[model samples]
Target: MKPTLVTQTALFIFSLLLYCAACPAQTAQPAPNQTAQKVYVGAYVMNLYEINPDAHSFYADFYLWFRWKGDIDPTGIEIVNRIEDWGANDEPFSDSVTVLKDGYNYNGLRMEGRFFHPFEMERFPLDRHVLDIQIENADYPLDSLVYLPDTANLIRMKPTLRLPGWDIEGCSLTAKTHMYATDFGNTDLGQEPYSNIVLEIPIARPVTYFLLKLMLPLIIVLLSSIGALVIFPSRSYVDARISLPIGGLLTAVFLQQSYSDALPDVGYMVLMDKVYLLAYAVIGAVVMEIILSANYLKRNKDTNLHALRRIEWYMALFLILGFLAGNLLLVFL
Candidate 1:
């Protein structure tokens, strides 16, 4: 009975050993959750110049700084909206990291470069735009690091900063996580969001440019075309009436082209274009009126010159008032 019991115990121990070897103990463990580090960013715009709508770019010079805690380096930054210009940009203001009295690491630099912005030209001379400067840490993902706007003095511009033909309305600063669509071929990392800081300057064209430079010339062309109706309805004055409107039409086309040249090609017409279209229609109506009147006089041997003059005056008044009213609606509403 004792020998049989020993044999059974040996078999049980052997089975237990086989089970342990087949299962194997797990050595890999899941990583613990880590809190993302925060980096404070600030900027002071010194100058904004060379704003060119045709090129869809503008030049800016600004001072940029960063404040962060711990050993993580957040100074490896990239200007997301900057256009690459070989050797034209300024170097960093600091050669090494700055240790502040409050136990934070700081670094700063003066940046000068051209930035890209897709200008909305629907309003053209009356358009308003917000020029922005976007900064991102090229090395750190939002999971590991995030940005905080130095709200105390987030965005400051030079007191004397001026952009010709543009009025600076105000400025704003913000920080947010910007996500890229692709994983950048890193399946392990997946699609990571990056912390970004944006400094925006709202600007608008001066009202004088719209009123005097653009609208005034258009008004002149319109008045000149309307003047064609003032000429007397006689065989001798028919050439004058026809030629005046034709000249005004040519001038209007040239004026539209001049402003259109300053803007990029867009799919739809702008407010100015709409105004010019009204002018064209009015001029065309004048041409037709002159032709019809000339035809009527030829068909009837005795057409009253005084009665025809009265009709022409009424037509001119109607067209002028209609044009003015249409312009007001287009501009205001």
Candidate 2:
């Protein structure tokens, strides 16, 4: 027989109570474990490779070494060169991987790639530059990965290797944390920071190269053009004197353009540009000296000829000394 209304209501209440008792109470989720893995980073540059000042990029060949805990296979961890736009990955460049006596995993990566870097060309051929190699794990956040600089085996450029225009002075490594922001869809990830290891190789340019190739020619042309002022002012050689300084000015302009093409576009004038400006000034002075001396001679002023010649000597000396001083200041200061 069917139960009465009161009985049916009582049965329904009992079932509800049983369901509540069987189910566990809800609690907040535990926070994610933010434990970090220790990784040792080392690098050795085997080749200086190529440097493109116009493009503001460089190519380097180096052996990148890493030692990490064996508990996790860091092979999947992304290795990024922090200072450059180039990417490096595990591509079987190693002959074999080694397991350290301390139970750590070690691997060496043979990396040869082009990296974009902002080259400072204010000094140009006389400049010393620091080429940096930065590495980090892409997948692991800073809280999950910490890079330790391998000081004992720090990054070094081969000593025996000599670059044509550069000399390697020193090498060093530094450890730091890099902070990065994520996209909107990855807000749960929030702003992630990564472990970064940086290797710096300081290279210096021998001023001798610039002295020989650039400064020597400039000096020669300037001296020749200024020498025109010493020639006795005569109608026969008037055109020659004027043409000499003009030709020197044109030569200086050509040299400046050629050198500028090798440098990156910068807001301010470089030391080389300053030197070119000095050349233009000296040439202008020489041209004026020629015209003035010629005009004085044309007027047939024999009494003032010696005075004019003496004045030319002083002006020429000033121009030469001024050019030298300006170049020295730009190079040393």
Q: Number of clashes in every candidate structure?
A: 0, 0
Candidate 2 clashing pairs, residues 3+ apart or interchain: none
Per-residue error for 136 in candidate 1, Å, reads 0.6
- Tell me the deviation in Å of residue 202 in model 1: 2.3
Error of 1 at 220 (Å): 1.4
Per-prediction TM-score: 0.82, 0.78
- Candidate 2, superposed: residue stretches over 4 Å from native: 1-35, 74-97, 181-184, 234-237, 264-268, 299-302
Candidate 1 lDDT by residue in tens digits, 89-180: 76676899989999989998888999999888877677899999888987988777877888878447888899988999877778866778
TM-score of 1: 0.82
Worst 10 residues of 1 by lDDT: 27-36
